[model samples]
Target: MSITFEKLSYTYQTGTPFEHHALQDISLTIADHSYTAIIGHTGSGKSTLLQHLNGLLKPTSGKLVVNGQMIDTKTKNKQLGDLRHEVGFVFQFPEAQLFEETVLKDISFGPKNLGKSETEALEIARQKAKLVNLPDDVLEKSPFELSGGQMRRVAIAGILAMQPNILVLDEPTAGLDPKGRIEMMEMFKQLYEKEKLTIILVTHNMNDVANYADNVIVLEQGRLLRQGVPTEIFSNPEWLNKHHLGLPQTTAFALKLQERGINLQELPLTEKKLAQKLAALLQREVK
Candidate 1:
């Protein structure tokens, strides 16, 4: 499913003394079935933008097109529930929201609530459990009994069980170790490949964007700063630095080498690309 925002501006507590404008004149079209990463510093309207994806928040003055539904000032909040079913949102720290007695029940909650039979829901849940790398043995255990990483998998399984065409993630790998973070991002990448899931991710992790995103949306203080492929975006280091945004760790290292007068062909986005470029440059020196 695609998302098109046209001059979309969201204001909180309009007309009140504490009123704040979280988004301003945001216009962008996120193509269907693409891995899009939204990156920005805190309070830059990143989370606010994510809320609008599945209609958790309505536009205060402008228009937003989600999937195909148009949301404007006159749009009713009730109409959003059905749209949410097609675009499943996995909130930041979604594991905290799990309160089901068993992991299977937790994963099946959405399908069951959507009118699926107990048998159907359980079958879907079991399939999703395997999708998230949760073994069958843990299906009967309480979600709280699982490790933090396993709990995260269960939480993601719940969203997958809903069979959404579009998946919206909010800082999904926030509190994981290096390995856990890589594994979780890889799992999402797999969904994008195998299920053709349209993934919209809101994250501060630049490396994840470099490694996994097909398109990158940069937000700054409630405004659209830039949007493009990660390579094109990272190529402009001066602009990113001016905005106080960061680069992937390897990309930054490559930049440091540039400062030391190392002449690699271009800035590489990932470690593998960086290594290949460095290896070619070294071979030239040997020659």
Candidate 2:
């Protein structure tokens, strides 16, 4: 499902002295089955823009259309509930939402809340658990007893059990080690390929964006600074740096090579691609 935002704007504490505009005339379109990363510094309105995608927050002005439904203050609560089912949101540190006594119960919560039978919910939970790499034995254990990474998988499984078409993650890899982070990202990539899921991840990791996201949206102080493919966004390091963002390490290395009189016209964002380009350059120079 696609989402379209048209001149959307939202203000916190509207009509009060503490009023703050979180998004200003934001307009963008997220196509179906695409992996999009929204990157920004803290308080740059990245989270605010995401909240509007599933009708979690109504736009104070302008329009938001998700899967062809226009979202506004007058939209019925029932419609909002439907939208939530289609767009599953996994909050930062999703493990904190694990409150049920057991992992099975915790992961089934979403489907159960939506009126699924006990047996059906459990089956769905099992499938989701497998999707998130949760072991069968973990189902019977208390969620609070699992490690931080395990808890995160259980929480994500909860959303997957709902079978949403669009997946939105807020800092999905916030506190994980390097290996854990790579595992999570690879899992998401597999899901996107297998299920044709539209994935939108909000993060500060430029490397993650470079490696995984097909499209990158950069936000700065409640405004969209740039939005494009990873190659387009990272190739111009200076432009990104001007907006308080940076290219991936590989892209930076390519930039440094250019600065040292190396004439690599195409910038490389991944280590594998960079290695190939560097090999070609060396071969050409030796001849």
Candidate 3:
């Protein structure tokens, strides 16, 4: 489903001292079945903005419209619950939220909450486990007994079991090793393509944004800094550097080559493409 944030503004601890404005007149639209990444440094309101998407946090002022429903401060609890099911949020280190005695129970929690029978919930959990690449045997084990990465998959499976159309994740790959991070991102990409799920990822990893996100939203100090396709966003290394962000290594290298009169017709976002361009350049020089 599509999401629209119209002149949304939010504040923390309103009507008292220490009231801080988290978001300021933010406006954006996220199309259905599209993958978008929100990138920002700490305290830039990235997390706060994400919370508004699924109704976890209401805008102190303005509107949050998701799937054509307006989630204002007066949105009832029942309506908020429904919104939660429609937009599943996988918070940063979602694995920490797992609490059931067994993986099966944990993953089944969401479906069960939605009134699914035991058999149906278990079936849904199994299907979600497969989606997240969790093994069948892990279902019977205590969630806490599993490794950190396994717990992460199980937590994600729990969200998937709810069958939300829009999956919003906040720093989903944090704490994972390089290989694990890549695997996790690829799994999300596959899930998005196969299930036609709309994904909104909030992360600091420029490389992940380069590899997976169709569009990029850059935030600075609780305001929209930039929003555009990855190529358009990354093309301005100076702008990114000015915001204390950097382009993908491939893009940085291509910029360096461009500076030396090596005009690659297209910017590269992957190491393999950069290597191929460098090889062709060497061949031309040799000739």
Q: Please, what are the lDDT tens digits per residue for candidate 3 over residues 1-287?
A: 58888888999999889999889999888889999999989999999998887777888888979987898878776777777888888888998898999999999999999999999999999999999999888899999999999999999999999999999989999999998998999999998999999999998888888889998888888898889989899877777788899888788888888998898878888888888988998899999
Higher-TM-score candidate of 1 and 3 = 1
Candidate 1 lDDT score at position 230:
94
- Report the C-alpha lDDT of model 1 over 1-287, residue by residue, as the tens digit: 57899999999999999999999999999999999999989999999998887777888868888788888888888888778888888887889989999999999999999999999999999999999899889999999999999999999999999899999999999899999999999999999999999999999889999999999999999999999999999998898999999989999999999999998768998999999998898898999
Task: List ranges where model 1 is wrong by over 4 Å.
Answer: none
Find the candidate with the highest TM-score and give its number: 1
Model 3, 133: alpha-carbon shift in Å? 0.9
Ranking by TM-score: 1, 2, 3
Estimate the TM-score of every prediction: 0.97, 0.96, 0.94
Clashing pairs in 3: none
- Best-fitting candidate, measured by lDDT? 1
In the predicted model 2, the residue pairs found to clash are none
